[model samples]
Target: MQTHELIKALAADSRRTGVAMNTVWWGAVLVAIVVATTIFFALLGPRPDIAIAAQTVRFLFKFVVTIALAASAFALLRMLSRPETDPRGLLPYLVIAPALILTGVAIELIAAPAETWSSRLIGTNSLVCLTFIPLIGIGPLALLLLALRHGAPSHPALAGAIAGLAAGGIAATFYASHCTDDSPLFVATWYTIAITILALFGALGGRVAARW
Candidate 1:
């Protein structure tokens, strides 16, 4: 309300500069895909029988969950990048993927016998799942954290975490193709853990990078 405060605010606004948020975000999306895909191929490409795998509902479901997560997190992170955006209204979107995964899990539990449940959850590549999702995601996470610095986010840490979620989703989508484990149980457990790791890293990175 004061003249000095008004001048200071105007000065701050003037100092903010660069590409439009849309341009920056879309650019980040493309770059992230490149970065994640590069890592995926270098580490592990799609499974050998992906053509056959494509026929299964469970195999296809992995993409549905991962893409949903990426889309939701991307939308929220974009909102969080702006100081004026509330982000709360969009919070529900984040749960959609998780809920879908849970539903898949429930369906899996019902369809499969109890004896096989443990094997389904454990999977053949639990270690690989843990290792590569984070590995592939780290680059995109860093990219997003850096991108967040371009905007005046009120919740830098949260924004960074969402960036990680987006990165995780992207990584998982690629990883899912190569993964032999198609059970929802495996995805719900291992995939969630892998993504959470990236989210944690993103939070720390956000705290440091997005700080004003």
Candidate 2:
């Protein structure tokens, strides 16, 4: 092939690849939000007390943590998309949400009665948390996996894990609205378990489906 023709072809291919990646990233975000919102409304809408300012803030706090985690994980997933990219730079961002939550847990422990610690930690909705989080997360996770495939990540499992974190975060945000348990103890325990379960599933799924 002529030199000019070869260069043109490479440029075209690069542009196409860039467009594809953008499509996947934005598409995944839109689909995740729409599907999660639909499920939330169809299944368990916001708690009845959501209108109250204090209750709203309480729920909003959890939403912030989960959504922040999701955003950070999404950023990490984008970084992992390139085969030669290193993920270490993005790791600290991923921990911000959890660290904030841990701080909240410490404060709650200091302020709340020791006698109520177990009850708050256990919460009334542990089983419900386990069920709804993973259930709602499945759609978003699947969408994220589909989107990640376009990037051709080197470590499929890691990419998948991050995608799962994003999905789980989105799902947990929705779940927080329905959850009556507002204590940071409850979030530290049950919410963590639910998100971990989704991450595990994402890891396993990525192992099988995220390969180049």
Candidate 3:
């Protein structure tokens, strides 16, 4: 075939594939994540005191921060899904949410009593936070990795890691409702650890699953 015809054919193929991937495949994966998460939350239920305005607000704050991080990381993941796309421009922005939360943590510490700080930091639900966040995150992480397969990612592990961040963020958002600990210290410590663990899992999974 002539060069012009070959180019046209490839372009048409790319467009068709893009549409299918974006519409059908991506939508299915998103719905799966939502359904799975909703089921998990229904079975587990939010903390009993969640109706209390003060407690609910605290949980909501944590959820907002986590979702923000997930949103930014997911955006980056989408960009990285395409080969040769550099995420440098948007990468730095990922820290904004965490930085703001950490600042709040610092202020909280300064305001609280010295001895109480340790208890707040160590929160009663540390173990639960660690366990549930990753547990809930597994499905989303898998789905994100599956989505990444639709594109050509140059650095599979890195892409996977970002997907993990997105998954972790999402998991943390759901876990927040069940978590009783409202202090920023608790969130900064345990939530961060849980999210990081998922990110590591993503890295490992990416090495195997995301390989082009």
The lDDT values for all models are: 0.89, 0.84, 0.79
Each prediction's TM-score versus the true structure: 0.91, 0.89, 0.85
Better of 2 and 3 by TM-score: 2
Alpha carbon lDDT at 119, candidate 1: 98
CA shift of 172, model 2, Å = 0.6
Can you write out model 1's per-residue Cα lDDT over 1-212, one digit (the tens) per residue?
97556545634663474346677888888899999999999989999999999999999999999999998999888878766556677779799899999999999999999999999999999999999999999988888887888887777888888998999999999999999999999999999999999999998898899876
Deviating ranges (above 4 Å) for candidate 3: 1-17, 24-29, 53-57
Worst 10 residues of 2 by lDDT: 6-15
Ranking by lDDT: 1, 2, 3
Q: Give the backbone clash total of model 3.
A: 0
Highest lDDT model number:
1
> How high is the lDDT of residue 60 in model 3?
70
